[model samples]
Target: MNIRKTLATLGISALVGLSAAQAVAAGTIKIGSFLAVTGPAAFLGDPELKTLQMYIDEINTKGGVNGMQLELVHYDTGGKAKEAVGFAKRLIKKDRVDVIVGGSTSGSTLAVIPLVEKDRIPFISLAGSVKIIDPVKKWVFKVPHTDRMAAAKIFEDMKKRGIKRIALISGSGGFGKSGRSQVLALAPEQGIEVVSDESYGAKDTDMTAQLTKIRNTDAQAILCFGFGTGPAIVTKNVRQLGIELPLYQSHGVASKKFIELAGAAAEGVRLPASALLVADKLPASDPQKGLLLAYKQRFESKYGPVSTFGGHAYDGLMITVRAIERAGGTDKAKVRDEIEKTRGFIGTGGIFNMSPTDHLGLDLSAFKMLEIKHGDWTIVE
Candidate 1:
């Protein structure tokens, strides 16, 4: 044990320790997102992806989350459930993401929840599905209001407005079916009778027949539900048939593209949406005003104008980041536990409260009733 040899070994050990510490400090946190970037639901997924990119860019520019750069790895599910499941597995097993976000629809979100839960990763679903958070799953959370909540709001509004009869049309998909069932189930309680109920396939190009039947009924309004191109078809056909009754829709049609696709037909359409979309018209001192403006300016600077879908993504990702910050690390389990304890989180959407029994983080109060006027969404009292 010569003195020179002892000193050399001690220096080598110290260098190795410093290298390990640096590696840990410089580690990157990977977030995975699956969306229908190229399929029928591209209208929703494209803006959501853009929002995720904008948020990550801004976070990185501000030194990132906890001094670690955030990396978002996205996959295009093409509106297919099987592809979503496969991508989720790849994100977990290969990319090794710290969390998952930005699923565009209920089907895609629900398909990936099991994979996330199996891998014990935190997943914040941007999709609006009550089932995504129902039963209080530990690894899953959602940003948008559930179809049941939207249905209740729509029906309650109709009842208040003295609409006694309604015709329902929804696509034969998970999102559509869920919304339709919720509306139908809640109509009786709201004292509004569903005069006629009809459904069409997701790929249907025209719903003339269904709209005609509803038009012949004594319904005062048409309640439509679907994602992708189905909603557009419903709106177009309803207009082409010259049905003058009011059209109420699910929040899935909150995107600007929905109005573009439906053109003039969407003028009087009504739906429930997060307050962020109509924030410009809200009072300046509103609680969500600051956050919404900040998010809007950052998003527009990074990637053009922001859409409602983008707003949802921004809210979801920010909440996820806040949970990680509170946890002090990227440990998935710890973050999930903290997320369930989220309270009074004043995000771009609204205040949220996530509990062990409530994973959506939002309630009926989170949504504001809105109507499309002159191709723009206007808040309704």
Candidate 2:
């Protein structure tokens, strides 16, 4: 009896070891990300990473997909493109993540694209630059409304207001450069003239010099295309230089932080933003109202308040999750195909309509014209 028991114990131990080996071979479905979690772009990446982690935990709580737990590995790129490229390679080659959702800034997204394309991995970027999807790389996709779309929306709004001459002041960042290009290229088609196009460094504390140049132009309206604190500086500079042209910012500064940064100077400033900014104000008839409200509540409940940048990350992660569910497995090719076939999916950014040719999947309608009133965001009726 003792000999028989000893043999059974050995057999059980060997079976357990083999099971462990098999588990290691199969591996969990890896979801990797790299964002500008620290540094100048922290405002964008902090909320994004938080929202992604929160939703991921929620998914795990409900039980992960296909009876396997999801594994998330993240790195901070400090809003630097070079840093982003290194991490992208590590996530794919070393960590072997099934899907990647990141590149918080446009520069970082553009930086990581070559590696993602070469590896043929499905990369859903949170970056806002239209250049991220313009060439239409098959393996790459994005969540934010393109800068081109935002520019078109702004120009259309300007035309409706009977404004003709506009000045463009952009930052040297990829996002600002992309916005400037689009606005310039589309202005003639839209029957508006760009009287002045000025640029400033991302870290420039003041833009009085650029505003001085813009003041000399016949611009009836001024478009300041930048993110983070650059736009705030423009607002202050515009007010200080006594330039009375209506100031319109890009959607990059569609957060309360901008108002706080610019203080009273941000008053009456106009910009384009997603419905998520004024979700509570949206009527019940609006298609995006429910989804926007739910997301806002969920995010703000845990992480203070929601930023439009955070919505970009939320869109990327949800789209990735939907693609995984639709594909029914961790097959990279199948998931990529599923993501490409996505359509009519209403997200925080817009109603996504992905295809072989259009990876960003947003339109001009995604933008809601907004104004800053008394340090608060109000939808321009």
Candidate 3:
């Protein structure tokens, strides 16, 4: 077998005969994944899968982690929770992946939580939802800043501007719904009132009606909490209706694709995001600057522009690998314990300090408030 070729390219033929223990004995570590690689949420999962493959390939090239070659067994969930459940089961039962790093959406991640916890396997989710780790499931950890964190960051920014009585337009999907709930739950404390609240279906073509409704309200600003193209459409609709009330978006649309999709309408739009989007603009003193720049260069060179979603995958995979290294092997229990013990681990998102009660290992500081300026990302102070 050519060691240079990524195990992801080896297909099932290579993973067939190795039992979980046998695979470890044969100097291989399996990392199973189930992502929405091809679906409405493709924007989130496509780059995620690519980032995983790229890093795994690079890691294997420089002598595998702890002298063991890494193998990936991934499945496409098409952004569906039911499909995610089936694929996750396959990964746990058949592929026997020592650790799982997947779930492009909150729905998918939440669906597979029971399975991972019951099976006693370590799972690092890439999706952004507080519920994924809020209750603190033993076997589950996550990379992206939670939706609740995003909400808090946005609310803090709004408070800074002395903005009150805001409108909320959200998507009905998992991330959007969760983010909306958090925003509502946290707004009262910030002295922000929900002047108008509306939601659009995940596949909704037009949000002009929602924008019109929000415009009629006595709202000071509008916050759109949604993922994929839905928020982009909302951005366009807000512009189309001439409703320029200082729009804010959730971290869901932190990718350059949102700017491209929403065109000039995206300009002046503010959102919470990772430093990955503005790597070059980050000050040299920032701890994540060097790592973010390196990851940006590598990913953009191989793929196109890097997205925060991909960065989430980068953190998840590296965190898992580091946990395995700390555990000295892929013993499930030990790895899980090490993952929970991760502290001061700098990643593309932020410095992680996980604990028994906090599996996500990130605070509001993990998100940098950003705005779209001149068709590019600009840091918002």
What would the per-residue lDDT of candidate 3 be over residues 1-381, giving only the tens digit for each residue?
576565655655566654655746568899999999998889889999999999999999999889999998999999999999999999999888899999998889999999999999999999888889988889999998888888899999999999988999999977788888999999998889999989999899999988888889999999999888899999999999988699999888887779989999999999999888888999889999999999999998989888888988999999999999999999999999999999999999999999998898888888899999999999998
**lDDT score, candidate 1, position 300:** 77
Report the C-alpha lDDT of model 2 over 1-381, residue by residue, as the tens digit: 699999999999999999997686474678999999999889889999998898888888889776666778999999899999999999999989999999998899898888999998999999887788889998999998888888898988898889999999999987788888999998999999999989999888988888888898888999999887999999998998878889999988988889999999999899999999999888789898998999899998987988888888888888888899899998999999999999998899989999999998888788899999988888887
Which pairs clash in the backbone of model 3? none
Q: What is the C-alpha lDDT of each candidate?
A: 0.85, 0.89, 0.91
Model 3: residues with Cα > 4 Å off, grouped in runs:
1-25
Error of 1 at 125 (Å): 1.2
| Total backbone clashes of candidate 1, pairs 3 or more residues apart or in separate chains | 0
On a 0 to 1 TM-score scale, where does candidate 3 land against the true structure? 0.90
Supply the TM-score for candidate 2. 0.91
The CA lDDT at 132 in model 3 is 90
Could you tell me the lDDT of residue 328 within candidate 1?
91
- The root-mean-square deviation over C-alpha atoms between each candidate and the true structure, in angstroms, is 6.0, 4.5, 5.8
Q: Is candidate 1 or candidate 3 better by TM-score?
A: 3
TM-score each candidate: 0.86, 0.91, 0.90
